[model samples]
Target chain A: GAGVSQSPRYKVAKRGQDVALRCDPISGHVSLFWYQQALGQGPEFLTYFQNEAQLDKSGLPSDRFFAERPEGSVSTLKIQRTQQEDSAVYLCASSLFGQVIYEQYFGPGTRLTVT
Target chain B: QQPVQSPQAVILREGEDAVINCSSSKALYSVHWYRQKHGEAPVFLMILLKGGEQKGHEKISASFNEKKQQSSLYLTASQLSYSGTYFCGTEFQGGSEKLVFGKGTKLTVNP
Candidate 1:
């Protein structure tokens, strides 16, 4: 079975530019999560969606960050204004169920660099 | 709060054994383990739910001490393929849907 997939494995954007990262979850996954990982650190939670409902967004750093999963399958994380602080790897993960106990299958991630 | 992982890094020769530990201050409902190589996605190793349960995967195993809010991962006879960064994600009690991950412990297994 195909694992989670993220598009544009690498991206480079100027400061103050807008960027969008896409994620395609597994065929039957009901849960999706987004995380940000800086160099030499573990991933930090960004947001979570159960089906099409945005269940948790507290992990999002600021208002500039936004995410949506309208069809309960593909998800997009958009940043209104990119900053040097946002330069990191964005990871997407999906689970078969919406519960916290389920294992999450992660995508290869999209590395974004804001200059 | 994020969990704390001990021994920021470790190196062992093939066939050697090593242990990695994770601890949290808050009450935890479950602990998840993952292994990630450079520039790759994290691969799930196992999950240990509350009740101090223990689980195993291949030559690797883990134990969760719910009372102590801590978990330990044991690697027996480590293989070169086991070299990577090990992370522990903690899910707190009270319906926390997100995982707070630790800084990660890098394991290097040399043949």
Candidate 2:
């Protein structure tokens, strides 16, 4: 089976530009999550979705960030007016169950660099 | 709060053993371990739930201590393939589904 995957492995944008990163979770995974990882640091939570319903978004840095999982499988994280601080690798993960006890399968991630 | 991991980095030789520890201030429901190579996604090593259960792989093992809100990952007879950054993700008992991660422990195994 194919593992989790993300599109646009790398991206560079002007500070004020908007960017959208896409994620394709493992087939049939009901729980999806997004995270941000800065260089030499651990991944920080961003948001999560259980099917089409977003269960949590408290980890989002600010209003400039938003995410959606409309069909419950594919997800997108959009950043408006990107800042240099927003430069980091965006990671997407998924688990078979909604429970936190389940192991999360991660994607390669999309590295976003804001200039 | 983010859990704290000990020994920010470690260097080892093949056939040796090492232990990485994680401690959380808040009560935890589970501890998840992951290893990541340079320029790659994190790979799940194991998950330890509450109740102090121990899980094992060929040469890897983990233990959860609910009372202390801590977990330990053990690597025995280390292999070259085991070199990478190890992270511990803590899920609070009453917190959301998100897992708060520690900085990371970089492990380098030399042959």
Candidate 3:
């Protein structure tokens, strides 16, 4: 079976620009999550979606950061007004169920940089 | 909230034993251990519930302490393949699908 896959493995944007990172979750996975990993740091939760509904977005840093999973299988994380401080690796993960007990399968991630 | 992991980094010799600890400020429902090699996704090692029971994964066993709100990973007879960053993930109450991960501990296993 194919694992979660992300696109644009690398993205470079100008300051104050907008960028969209895409994630294709494994087929039928009900839980999808996005995380941000800064250099030399651990991955930090960004947002989560259960099916087509986003259950949580408390970890999203600011209004400029938005994520959506419309059809429940694919997700997109968009950052508006990107800043140099926003440089980091964006990761996507999916699990069989919405339960936290299940092991999450992660994508290779998209490295976003703002210059 | 992020958990606290001791010995932010450690070096070990092959066949030696190493222990990594994770502690949380709040009560947790479960603890998950994962290892991430360089340029690779994290691989789940094991998960331990609040109970005193210990879960073993290929000679790597982990135990959760309810009283101390902490957990420890025991790696016996370490191998070079074990060189990677170890992370401890904590699941809070309510099963909200949020997992807080530690900063991770870098372990370098020497031959």
- Using lDDT as the measure, which candidate wins? 1
> How big is the positional error of residue B93 in model 2, measured in Å on the Cα after superposition?
0.7
Error of 1 at A46 (Å): 0.5
Candidate 2 regions off by >4 Å?
none
Q: Rank all candidate structures by their TM-score, best first, as comma-separated numbers.
A: 1, 2, 3
lDDT of 2 by residue, A53-98 (tens): 9999999999999999999999999999999999999999999999
DockQ of each: 0.91, 0.93, 0.72
In order of listing, the candidates' clash counts read 0, 0, 0
Q: Note the Cα lDDT for every prediction shown.
A: 0.96, 0.96, 0.90
| Per-residue lDDT over B22-55 for candidate 1, one digit per residue giving the tens place of the 0 to 100 score | 9999999999999999889999999999999999
Looking at model 1 chain A, which ten-residue stretch has the lowest summed lDDT? A96-105
* Highest-DockQ candidate: 2
TM-score attained by model 1 = 0.99
lDDT of 1 by residue, A10-99 (tens): 999999999999999999999999999999999999999999999999999999999999999999999988999999999999999989
Residue-wise C-alpha lDDT for candidate 2, range B60-88, written one tens digit per residue: 99999988999999999999999999999
